[model samples]
Target: MHKNVYTADNAAMLLIDHQVGTIGWTKSHDVEEIKKNAILLAKIATAVGMPLVLTSSMEDNAQGPLLLELDETAPEAFAARIKRAGIVNAMDDENFNSAVKATGRKKVVVAGITTEVCVVFPVLQLLDEGYEVQVVTDASASFTKIGDDAALRRIEQAGAVITSTSQIVSELAVDWTMPKGQALGKLLNLGA
Candidate 1:
């Protein structure tokens, strides 16, 4: 497989800061839509048996905790979620970084609550560390359109693939008759 390409076998997922308090700060995309797309990523990871890591920042204060639906969708990942003390950049948190490294997959699919900071910071760091990163656009949002658009441009310029939830679903599904494909089709109402 090409280094730029990501498949279920070669990819892992890293969801950052999808917390209740932080989600409301998002104005780039619909809050519910972001939640749904993020959940879809979790479901995709679960269906394909891909490794998934979830991280949150300052849950007890303002950030709140990761979405409960994410926990319910991919319980195993939720069980091992990294609860960061106050790290804005998840990759800076040793536990979060270690968890991502433990997946042993260099191709990472990432999504987060805020596009400008929460999503962009670790993505840049991951790219610097030679990881192939794909940022799910709709699954991550920001406080304003300008910030979100700027962040998307910045990451794309830095070599991370700027992609969408539907694109990832399509890339991973491949065949509608397969289990992962069928699961994704039903979830997205693709009529498989």
Candidate 2:
């Protein structure tokens, strides 16, 4: 497999700051729909045996905790929760950065709430560090449509591929005859 391509072996999934408080403020997409997408991504990643990282900004305070469905569906994948003290970006937190590095996969499929801040910050930094990053747009949102649009444009301009949840799952699965592909189809309700 090419190093730059996103395969099950080369890709990891990172979810950042998808908390109740933050999710409630998202105006770019329906919060319920985003939740479903996020959960589907988690399930698909877990089913495909992908390395995963889950993080929250200020779970102890106003930002609230990660959605329960993520934890329920992919408990093991929810391996790390970097509770940032004051860092606006999860990449700025040492533990989060270290967890990502430890995965050893250079292609990261990432999404987060409030696209401009939570998602973009670490993506740009990861791109600079030479990771092939793909941002799952539907799995993330912002306080407004404009903010979400601008953030996605900024991420694209910075050279990250903007993708959707199903696209990521298909890319990772490769073929329907494979076990991972079969599992993904079932998980997505596409019928095996």
Candidate 3:
């Protein structure tokens, strides 16, 4: 079978603030479910060999520390790549965007906190630039369901694809015969 239009090799995973402080504001998705999906998103990249870029607003001297599980699922080397952008939408922030662009991959699998700014702005910008962006909706959220929906609508209008983390992982996996297929299945608790 042929590779998907934009294969994982051409893709990058950008997981935004899955921080402990921001979890409360994620009104679109259940807190427990969001954490599950976040870890699963991390596992997907590990399984599929996709490069992941994690970013947070401000960890040190900020509101609170990041989720411990976030660092556990994504180690120092992985988390070290995390951008310490003070801006909500790292993609809109010059330094953050430059750092992401430096990775040199066009396709992006993105998730973030508060869908309005953190998730929405970046997805639309990337889409406008002709980048194939998959916004992981379930893996992100906002202060309210209405806000999250609004963000989704804006990104869709801009021609970006809104999807769940699992959906993004499934699409990138493409088939059941991938090299790490079984492992991916296990991580997602598919019981394969």
Candidate 4:
């Protein structure tokens, strides 16, 4: 626990701007698949009692609202998970950054719609502060494949560990022998 390693209990999951508007630019992956990944990530995080923060862009003006499935995946999050104006760029919004910090966990496991701006900005800022940052690459996408690749490359070079929703949930399980073991195995398709 010197400074860099992270544990499940010490991690917080932040989902940003996953509104309908953001989903429109998800040209790097199948839209339906992204939704499933997002839901599964949130569900696992909630089930493990991890701290979760859900944010959206411009509900009143953009995206309209977070998808119902995303909201239902983490019911304990309940309320104003929608915080951005769907600004397309929210890198400098302290409110956005502050909301993330409020969760009080230094290790951030984050994913967002659109890989370049939404996901990269927060990852860089969080890294600057010495917080252990893990970016879920498969859980995020962009308007194009190029943007997705570049964003991921930049984030990786900036010291962010590019990861995935699958890895996080699997590691947290520790074992299938525990109560949650069988369920996680089945969800992850490790069942026989």
Q: lDDT by residue for model 2 over 53-163, one digit each (tens)?
A: 998887878788889888898887665566777588889899999999999988899999989999999999999999989999999999999999999999899999999
lDDT of 3 by residue, 4-106 (tens): 3445688888887777778776677798888778777877886777777777777674434566776777685245655564766677777667767876888
Q: What local lDDT does model 2 show for residue 75?
A: 83
Give the poorly placed runs of model 1, Cα more than 4 Å off.
1-3
* Deviation from native of the Cα of residue 131 in model 2, angstroms: 0.5
Query: What lDDT does model 3 reach?
Result: 0.74
TM-score for each candidate, following the candidate numbering:
0.96, 0.96, 0.88, 0.88
Q: What is candidate 1's TM-score against the reference?
A: 0.96
**Cα RMSD for candidate 3?**
2.2
Candidate 4 residues 1-192, lDDT tens each? 435544557888888777777787689988888887877778877777778788777777656677778767777573757476545545456666677678788888888887787888878878887778888887888989998999999989999998877787776676777756566666678881
Q: Candidate 1 lDDT, tens digit per residue, 118-174?
A: 989999999999999999999999999999999999999999999999999988887
Top of the candidates by lDDT: 1
Best by TM-score: 1
Stretches of model 4 off by over 4 angstroms after superposition? 1-5, 86-91
Question: What are the runs in model 3 whose C-alpha is more than 4 Å off?
Answer: 1-6, 61-63, 83-85
Residue pairs with colliding backbones in model 1 are none
lDDT for model 4, please.
0.76
Q: For each candidate in turn, give its C-alpha RMSD to the true structure in angstroms.
A: 1.1, 1.3, 2.2, 2.4
How displaced is residue 159 in candidate 3, in Å? 1.1
Please report, in order, the local distance difference test score of every candidate based on alpha carbons. Answer: 0.91, 0.88, 0.74, 0.76
Least well predicted 10-residue stretch by lDDT in candidate 1: 1-10
Ranking by TM-score: 1, 2, 3, 4
